[model samples]
Target: MSTATVASAPPAPRVQKRGTPLAKKRQWRAAYLFVIPFFVVFITMLIVPLFYSGYLSFFATRLVGGTSFVGFDNYVKTFTDPLFLAGVGRTGLFLLVQVPIMLGLALFFALALDSGRVRGSKVLRLLIFIPYAIPGVVATLMWGYLYGQDFGPIVQVLSALGLGSPNLLSDSNVLGSMMNIVTWEFVGYNMIIMYSALRSIPAELYEAAEIDGASQLRVAWSIKIPAIRPAILLTVIFSIIGSFQLFNEPSLLRNIAPNAISTSYTPNFYAYNLAFVSQNVNYAAAVAFILGIVIMIVSYVVQLSTQRRERLG
Candidate 1:
């Protein structure tokens, strides 16, 4: 009797599998969970501040009228301001001079390393990269001390060697000194980028070149350099951004060389002085926004030129 009852109850309904819609919904939920944090932080930290700055840039806060909308007056003033123009020109010069030297050195080092012929290449690479690991403030301070005319080690050594101590932080030479410091700091970082790109090239290309009796220089010029153009472009873009955003080094060096490094030495430095020192937040916002636009335009031009060259080639 038990066996008969068990057999009668044996028939059960089949469970249906979930549809694609349901599975997709679950996947979308997981994706949102992963991405929500980034969006939240980005909106809170960047988007909101940018919009607020843009809002501030259109208004004027004065002693008598309080805060009142002035339309594009702040922006017009920013475009015409000599201080702002000087800073822009200064940074443009910095980009032109420093970026070339830095990138050249970086490419040289990367090519040497990629050749696989340099002894203790790993050690040399690490040594080159160590400066970048140092904090910008620390690096600036370290360099500032070296550039000190009165008591710095460099000056002392020069004086001891009966060579007159040249003023590195002087008005005439300070920009070049800054360039040297920047080149020292960033060469390794750019080298690593180029080196990584070089390493990714197909080994068969090198083999083919070898079979064609190509010298190492010929192989690098024809294959490696062309292959790594994108990496070079990336480094150039980064250098351009960094050059325009040049603030920390100049700001820190101001204390060391007040006569040479002005409060408005760089666009960023000018913006900071306007906002904090002069208490002109509205104008400062406008200046900062304008500077951001300049950087975008310059970077866009560079990218466009690169693309055009690629198309032509």
Candidate 2:
């Protein structure tokens, strides 16, 4: 008699094949195809130059045959350079004072626009945002001329009134002057962003607040501000980064106020001068990297502090 034998089921299908050279090769080919352009441009423009800068930073450039390795000498020189240190300090000061004021103005304007009480709101918004639409160079040039001591109508009018116009291009007033220009350019830009966020908020919340007899101010404080906190945070982060990366306005203004604004007025300006004007590409790279790191750290700190406050509340 033959024994009854049960047929065994075939093994379950493998979802991922292991040790398959053909699959591996196909995957590699796909990856390469997907990344070819990025690698090409990145290597050509960014990666190769970055590595070269890193290598160069170890050496001091010479007017003669070749450069010699000095090992952190460039970095040491950066810290000890009074001009560099002063630029850093001035940049930090702008970030601290101007960023907050600009963001606050943006927030206030956004809230006002969102309130729906103001007639001709669209026109007002457009007018406010027009400055941002202007090219930075053009805007700076126009404002620079307007701040001119001799040619400016403002100074002329003030003189006629026997009230001396403050020298906006002076060393003491240059920072404030720059701040005003930046605020004018960016307030409406940031306001538009915050307004979009405010519009996204659910109307039901406001309706409920009104039902509870909350005033407009109370609704704004208790609901609108809290609801749009993320957008506010985003604008603050962007403003902080922009403040640190300031160059064009200061650079253009430098020509007008060379005595007050040095070749290194802002970190970006300093880096630019180092790389191009002075031909110290290595030191410029170091300073560029340092500025990037500083901005990152400050952004992170702002996020942390805001998060802590939210948690506490």
Output the number of the lDDT-best candidate. Answer: 1
Q: Count clashes in each candidate, considering only residues at least 3 apart in sequence or on different chains.
A: 0, 0
- Per-residue alpha-carbon lDDT of candidate 2 for residues 174-293, written as tens digits (9 for 90 to 100): 999999999999999999999999999998998899899999999889999999999999999999899889998999998788888888899889999998999888788778777787
Question: What residue runs in model 1 are displaced by over 4 Å at the alpha carbon?
Answer: 1-21
Give the CA lDDT, 0 to 100, for residue 120 in model 1: 99
For candidate 2, the per-residue lDDT at 110 reads: 89
Q: lDDT by residue for model 1 over 149-203, one digit each (tens)?
A: 9999898899899999999899988999899989999999999999999999999
Clashes of 2: 0
Superpose all Cα atoms of candidate 1 onto the true structure and report the RMSD in Å to 1 decimal: 8.0
Candidate 1 backbone collisions, by pair: none
After the best TM-score superposition of candidate 1, give how far the Cα of residue 237 lies from its true spot, in angstroms.
0.6
Give all candidates' CA lDDT scores.
0.92, 0.86
